[model samples]
Target: MAKATTTIEKRVPTQAEQEAEALQEVMSAVAKNKDALLTFLDVLGELHESGALDMAHGALKSRHQIGVIGMNQLNKSGAQNMIKNGMNTMQFLAQLDPNKLQTMLGAVASGVDNAVQPDAERPQKKPGLFDLFKQMRDPQVTSSIGMMLNFLRGMGAAKGRE
Candidate 1:
């Protein structure tokens, strides 16, 4: 009987080999696109210097439209996970230093203020009590309120026993 030989092929890449291959691919692409990429960056810088970029973006409704486009690509679960991850990451980053935490808080406050500010210095309309009650008619809102009430009641009962 003839002896049978089995050859096992290794499929996993070593970390160093993977890193070298990634670096090679990136360098190759950079070499190929260098001129066009430089030209694009120059044009972007010029636009920024001229204040034309912001005006163009505003005229094209780019910010809100791009946000909507990006949001549409996310499923509910993906968005929820992204939000959870972002909050967790922010908390971790904030804990890094006191200065970092203060900076982040300031940025958040500025963002909130900007969002609440009206366009062209106009005052925004405050919703009436009826309008607020109308929002409560939403099933999701009502369910969330019910859950919150139950939690509060449970806390109150616990306190009573103490």
Candidate 2:
């Protein structure tokens, strides 16, 4: 009978073998994504040609200075007010009924398109006071006036609460 094998030995990979395996995996990935890699390279070349890469590098190098300048600007009252106003506007829009807002915006766009005068008809005469009063009596004009009055009433109520 042959001698009984009592132990099994495991062979560990060498550093060079490990590196070769990693390179093979990376090459396989590159092969699999050849089109994407080529597209990315084309974009990179365009960016380099446009000096965008250099600009990006320069910006990165000056990041700390940029941060300080940004901070300084943001600390100003005007910037603070802009941020506050933006938040208030967003809050106000969020509270509106979406369907009504969509309809209102569509109507506003239509109204603006209708109001635009052709360049050839520049300086068309304004409506006279009597004409304006007559327009106020029109159904569409009355409806718009009512909408504006409701908006003003809501604003007034908000201001009063503040």
Candidate 3:
């Protein structure tokens, strides 16, 4: 019978060898993304040439001053008022029916467009009070008046609550 032999191997890499392995991986990645790296470098070079990079560096250096200026501006009464108004407007808009608002905005936009672009087919004439009263007979006009009346009633109720 032939005798069988088993071989065992154990190897630990040195620090330099491990570093070299990391460098090899980095080199492989650089090679794979060579085109992208080159493009990025080209853009950076252009920015540097245009002095944008310098301006950016200067801005970064004066970040504290920029922040102070911004804070000072925001601290002004006008800025505070603008912010308050914007918040009020946002709150009001949030409470509104989006569908109705959208429809109203669409109608307003269409009306503006029609006003800007006059129709050649229709004879333009200033509507008289009698003509307006005659239009009140229209169902569309009646519905709009009804909506306005309800809106006025709501405003009255709100004023009462206030």
Judging by TM-score against the true structure, name the best candidate: 2
RMSD of each: 21.6, 5.4, 7.8
Candidate 3's residue-wise lDDT over 102-137, tens digit each? 987886787688778857975578989998899799
Model 1 C-alpha lDDT versus the unseen true structure:
0.81
The lDDT of model 2 is 0.90
At residue 38, give the lDDT of candidate 3. 100
Q: Which stretches of candidate 3 lie over 4 Å from their true place?
A: 1-58, 117-122
Per-residue CA lDDT of model 2 for 1-162, tens digit only, reads 899999999999999999999999999999999999999999999999999999999999999999999999999879989999999999988999999999889878877876884346444577889978977877977988898899899899999999
Question: Candidate 1 on 101-148: residue-level lDDT in tens?
Answer: 686577668657766774665446687899779869978568758766
TM-score of 1: 0.29
Stretch of 10 with least lDDT, candidate 2:
117-126
TM-score to native of every candidate shown = 0.29, 0.60, 0.56
Ranking by TM-score: 2, 3, 1
Error of 2 at 151 (Å): 2.8
Give Cα-based local distance difference scores for all models: 0.81, 0.90, 0.90
